[model samples]
Target: MSRIAIVSDIHSNLEALVAVMRDIEAKRVKKIYCLGDLIGYGPNPNEVIDIARDNFEFVIKGNHDEAVAYKIPKRFKRLAAKAAFWTRREIKPRKRPGYREQRVRWQFVHKMPRSEQLGTWLMAHGCPTSNLEYIHDNETALQVFANEMGGSRICFLGHTHVPGIFTMDGGEVHYMEPQDGKRYAVTAERAIINVGSVGQPRDGDPRACWVLARSDGTFSFRRVKYNVDAVAERIYREKGLHTSLGDRLFVGE
Candidate 1:
């Protein structure tokens, strides 16, 4: 197996996506997997989806993606709901020159699966069973290991927008924050790895977060800096998106 890159929660920030893709390319990673949320809460939904469709090998259906593509009811807050609605309006096919292309991209998002199994690893936008679930604590991690792993030794997730590693061995579970460029050996009986967010990082660092997994049973977290102010300004200029969406980029909240 070749080394692969895992990214999630892009949230349509074109600058962050471009910067992360450049970093991935520089690392010589050939395969990239996306955990979804390709749109919503950012200014460039269509552009982000274009890049994702062109690059990622597979993309799991996230809550935001689901809401936007299907117009399904989700537990989004006021701002997120507003953004999702706006994204729907933005990506919805229209009677324009690019109508065919737009419909194709919309269908691409609409057809994304909820979960994918890669050899011994399971990939999901959140937990295996639900894209809306958040595996944020040891208890939730243990629950996933017991009930949701579906016979995989490792599960890769990206809904919390915070990078961390959870390992279960000898009937004990341990959680650790992943550091940039530090490779963590995948020796646990079961593990859940959160690759964090690519466009809207909430880990307080503000840089885009992703993970590089090697064929040698180890993975390292990577973060790349981009022009946050530019994206924030774009968000502010967009009438449908709220200002807080852009403001959060500066603080990584």
Candidate 2:
């Protein structure tokens, strides 16, 4: 089976991204798919972009990424807006190198569709229709599944930062704990898998979010432990980053 890694929401935590990559390497995975938000809410935004540009096979844009390339309006949650603003400043030429490179990639942010369907599998950062929607729970899944249900047998989603599986088996929903690196075979029924957050987790779990897909339509989920303290300290040290962002690393909320 050819396993490809699915990573999302690194949010500029280089330590976490590196740790997750180590986990991927240990599994011998080289092909990677990114669900966006590589920069935001933490340090080393450029480093995250560098690694992704060098490694990822497919990438979708996240709301935070779009906010940076385009102007984020006041309608966005102020906290998120603040983080995007701070992240843009932090990744500037003086603070972070590779701004031009990142910007070149950032320009593609707007072009990323809200969702992607590859044969039997679909991929998206949030809901199929909205990049900013949060598919965190079963209710959200029900609505999204109903809309995107088609020939595609499975859908992979992120942006909720809570890793879990929501399966539509004969019009019923069953939620499973994220697969711990073992592919869970799928039937003809549809499924929506939230890949979770890599740098920052919010499912009362501090580990990073991940997913693995094989050529034969088999897939798995992985959440690896990284240096949370290192990420927390960096955010705390950054002048413009809010304390709440740093403090959440401990709670994963």
Candidate 3:
């Protein structure tokens, strides 16, 4: 009856996060784990952080979260850089009356770990070791499985915003595409699971996606539709924010 809900890349889309949480609660999951990117790209960074702090039991730091807390890497594209800078101010505005409260929220993300080990499972925003790396393809996923030294046989990750699975067996790597409502059995082969994005999905699907991992060594991907237009409209209304950020929500980029 107990299940661990794995979520990631929320990207400050409150509407999508709310819908995903609703579906997660409906499934009666006991513990929720977030793989990070709680803010960035969207309009509601503080709201997403508050929900993440309140709901998720385990949280790992994401690249966007790092960019906001620390320095934006040179590798970051223009849009992401812009969003990170905007979020930095939005969370802890210079002349805001509630600076203390905003600082607390920012500190929450700063306190998150780059990776967490839970028994046989490893959770990270990107790869197990690097929060900025993207384990989207089989080669990259296999590299992490081989390089990372940890007891966890399974690694749950996010960052590319596309849900999929990679298995390492007998030194060979294979990738699996997940289906909604279908459970895939976890084998002795080490695996890396991408839970996709809760806010902005980039796999050509606009729905919010998360992973439902049971204690019995099986997991499933779930997608839920939310009010993309509402969030997009809100993004458009916010000044100093990119309009394309709102437009991409409708297309899932």
Any idea what lDDT model 3 has?
0.88
TM agreement with the true structure for every prediction: 0.98, 0.89, 0.96
Candidate 3 residues lying further than 4 Å off, grouped into runs, are 93-95
* Backbone clashes under 3 angstroms, per model: 0, 0, 0
Residue clash pairs of candidate 2: none
What is candidate 2's lDDT per residue for 61-95, written digit by digit as tens?
88888787678866777777888888777554443
> What lDDT tens digits, residue by residue, belong to model 1 across residues 16-72?
999999999998998999988888899999999899889999889999999998765
Model 1 bad stretches (over 4 Å): 72-74
Distance from true position, residue 76, model 2, in Å?
A: 2.7
In model 1, pairs of residues that clash are none
- The lowest-lDDT stretch of 10 consecutive residues in candidate 2 is 90-99
